[model samples]
Target: MSKANLSDNKMSATCSLSEELMALLPQTKESFKLDFSEKVEKSVVILLHQARELFYEGKMNECLKTSETIRDYSWEKLNTGTWRDVDKEWRRVYSYGCLLKVLCMCFKTDDIGEAIRVCDMGLLMGASILEDILVKVVNVLQKHLQHGKRPETKIEELSKKKTKSDHTLAPAVKLGTAVPILQCPSLEFFRKNYLVPQKPVILEGIANHWPCMKKWSVDYIQEIAGCRTVPVEVGSKYTDEEWSQRLMTVNEFISKYIMNKNDIGYLAQHQLFDQIPELKQDICIPDYCCLGSGEEDDITINAWFGPAGTISPLHQDPQQNFLAQVLGRKYIQLYSPEESESLYPHETQLLHNTSQVDVENPNLIKFPKFTEASYQSCILNPGQILFIPVKYWHYVRALDISFSVSFWWS
Candidate 1:
């Protein structure tokens, strides 16, 4: 047979196999829930379909290009607190794209080792939906290596280099002992000592004059916002798959999460002051916010109310924040933007603003850099305001049935 005819037959057979595998997968009526803008999702799906078509046509190079496009887009969308059961369908499609790219690398470029490394990355990203296909790819690559058909890839060379580099750095370094507390510093003093240096400081007596400081108890909050439906975070922390958003009345939130500690639910980041004008009258914005970009109208005031043990993961905000403790105590930790590399920020786009390492109980073996990242910690008391500069990493854990308000300014 002619070489052209032989190649055509092989492509036809491969297309048939691809179709059969896809057919075997179960179908669901539920629509895939991607945790991104609709524009991003649409673009990714288009590229994914293009990659599949190229694969069936036996255009390995074109298939690889299209597959890589999908992979890159997926990585960018992989944000923290966005991964959940609803994303499983999108993840499955992403895994298929990764597998196609691995096949092209192995068969077309003869890079068996690189193909294996790519497979490992896909698996790490919770792409087990294509486990059967990945296993087959790995086995084939292993056979190629055993036969000495391909050269060792760059991944192996990099691994050897990393081993030498790892030994050069110290295993761990301790963070700061404590955060400083200032007793109502003037606007100029605060701007110079804390805001200019981008440091964190707990300011006492800032909210003592606010009526909310004395009036915002569980009973008072329930009485005022009891009937209003508000968004609540229903989990101990935002990182879990079971973590989800719930909308309920303020009274229900107080009864379920605060009154009884059966499960941790939080009325976090809600604009209570805006929603209930009565609440806004109780507190006043500090004069320090005028030191910012001078956009007072653009400032956002948000409320955070939750039971003890509720946690806000290590994350950075785009605006300068003034976190005021109103009714309870909270333990907070802050890391400067300079230590971002040491904090091991997530590579995926979804969690680009958050750290992958758990600040409380860090996995040193997996994230050794976290140990070298120094931080300042404090226990925020009622009537204290914490100044957090833009992009400063902060993690918060309520020590009691805490109620805090945060003002975000430019």
Candidate 2:
């Protein structure tokens, strides 16, 4: 959606949405809340990396400023996208805000208590994170306290309260807020037989139903998408898939993805669609498209072939993502929306924490709060379909050589 549309669009219907979102959010807005999707998680990773780099470079002031900016931007972004958990974002901002505040204090040379106080301000903004940060304050003070600078009595009191409350939740019950549990099948068959429910699975039979299937393939996509000029970080790669879902012009997607695909001179995007006027006709699409009903005018696809370590970080699209596995299996770790606290989402909106955290060996220290995450696992087969709901946080990696098609639909 464009900025113009946001202002001119029928926001009257959505005005109440803003208020509802705010109320759902926890008092704390320091952390992020990545629900049954992946985008927000990726955004958080980027912030963590950026913050670490800045801290290491001794640009603490710059880093702090950027954190504040990201916090505000994330809220605005979520506000614009109706798909996000507005309430969760509210709490998330504060949770992460607390983390940033704590980091800021760690770097302060003057008074540790002052730094804790500064971080504690997030309590007013993101109370959950503030609570955690406040608990840590006395410990930090004790570590750096000079002479009798230690407020031992207050610190002990805080420590006792924290110890009283700290407890690992069940695999199902999430930390922080109490909400209803989402029941999912064991899906053991999909997990064990497949690559531990990792690979993207495409239902070839279903492709027969999609209007675009056989008509769109490597040969055809190459004609429409074209062997184009492109840019990348290290290598350039792309993939395509045809599915049979809606009975219409082009089955579903001419989805073109390229490895390390960069912006400038990306011919695959500029030419392919322009060349395929057949694809431009009144594409009715569907109500659940990732880009929604009308935006098919601006869509593209690519293929991936080269890479052992090639990985798409934890993230998600605003649409209902349909991923089909063609050859290899890719391990996927998905967290539900209810596990928002565990994900520690980003403060900004459009940009998710694309950082792919190793869920298996999560650097718990780096993502200390990640221990709060609760997720469902799955592995896609040659014909399996992974229905990734909007905003769910997913971390994926190829278990081996693999091929797949991700239909980013609403």
Give the alpha carbon lDDT tens digit for every residue of 319-409 in model 1.
9999989977788888899999988877988789988878889899999888787788887778899988899999888877788889999
Q: Pick the TM-score winner.
A: 1
Worst 10 residues of 2 by lDDT: 243-252
**Model 1 spans with C-alpha error above 4 angstroms:** 1-176
What's the residue-level lDDT of 392 in candidate 1? 96
Q: lDDT of each model, Cα atoms only? A: 0.71, 0.42
lDDT of 2 by residue, 1-410 (tens): 99878665535323333233233334443333323235456666567557645654667687777677656665564556463335554545644645554455455444544544444334323434423543344334334433454222332343344332222221222343222221232345334532233332222343333434335333343333221222222321121122111211111111222212221111212222222334333122322233344365433333332222344556655544655454445556676656666666555654454433555667888788777766666544344445565566676555433345554543
Q: After superposition, how far is residue 136 of candidate 2 from its true place, in Å?
A: 64
Q: Once superposed on the true structure, which residue ranges of model 2 sit more than 4 Å away at CA? A: 1-204, 208-227, 233-306, 347-350, 353-356
Query: CA lDDT of 171 in candidate 2?
Result: 28
Model 1: colliding residue pairs: 78-350, 79-350, 79-351, 80-351
